[model samples]
Target: MLTSKQKKYLKSEAHSLKPIFQIGKDGVSHKQAMTILDALEKKELIKVKLLDTCPLTVQQAALEISMQTKAEVVHIIGHTIILYKESEKEIYKLP
Candidate 1:
């Protein structure tokens, strides 16, 4: 779990980032989860977009992806969600 300050810091850090992946009409699939997990491992922090064509709610998609990838949900604004997971490479230090 992340502290409020930590989440706030992450949200600010994520503000300039573009969504690296999108959940479309197909919703979150295993392959999508794998890709997200890989990205999380490499980048530690990432942004994902829920397309207008997606069937799931933003909360649902964020929860599902966070659970599947074992990442933290740092923020959700509009259709974008910010996720983070600590990686062996140590790219970021949580606030």
Candidate 2:
């Protein structure tokens, strides 16, 4: 679990990042979740965008992806979600 402070820091860090992945009409899938896991390992923090065509709500998609990837949902705003997982590289020093 991320403290509010850590989440705040991550949100700021992710502010300028483009979404690394998008969840569309098909919704979250196993393959996509696995790919996101790989990405989180590499980047520590990432943004995922939900398209208008997506059926799942932002909260639902965030939960599914978080469960599948074992990454924390740092923040959700509009249709974008920020996720964070500590990596071996220790990419972002969290507060």
Candidate 3:
């Protein structure tokens, strides 16, 4: 779990990042989740974008992806979601 300050810091750090993945009409799938897990292992923080054709809402997609990847949903704005998981590399030093 992340504290408010940590989430804030992560949000700022992710601001300039492009979405590494996208949830489209097919919605979230096991394969997609697993792929996201792999990405999370490499990058502690990542952005996921939801397209207009997606079946799930932003909150639902965030919940499902976070649950599957065991990553925290740091922030959701517009159609983008910022997720964070502490990786082995300890890439970002959160305050």
How badly does each model clash, as a count of residue pairs? 0, 0, 0
lDDT, candidates in the order shown: 0.94, 0.96, 0.96
- Give lDDT: candidate 2, residue 23: 100
> Scored by Cα lDDT, where does model 2 land?
0.96
lDDT against true structure, model 1: 0.94
- Could you give candidate 1's per-residue lDDT for residues 5-85 as a string of tens digits? 989888888888899999999999989999999999999999999999999999999999998999999999999999999
| Local accuracy of candidate 3 as per-residue lDDT tens digits, 1-95 | 89999998998899899999999999999999999999999998999999999999999999999999999999999999999999989999989
**Model 2: pairs clashing at backbone N, Cα or C within 3 Å:** none
After TM-score superposition, what is the CA distance of residue 73 in candidate 1 from its true location, in Å? 0.4
Q: Cα lDDT for residue 54, model 1?
A: 100
Each candidate's TM vs. the true structure? 0.97, 0.98, 0.98
Supply the TM-score for candidate 3: 0.98
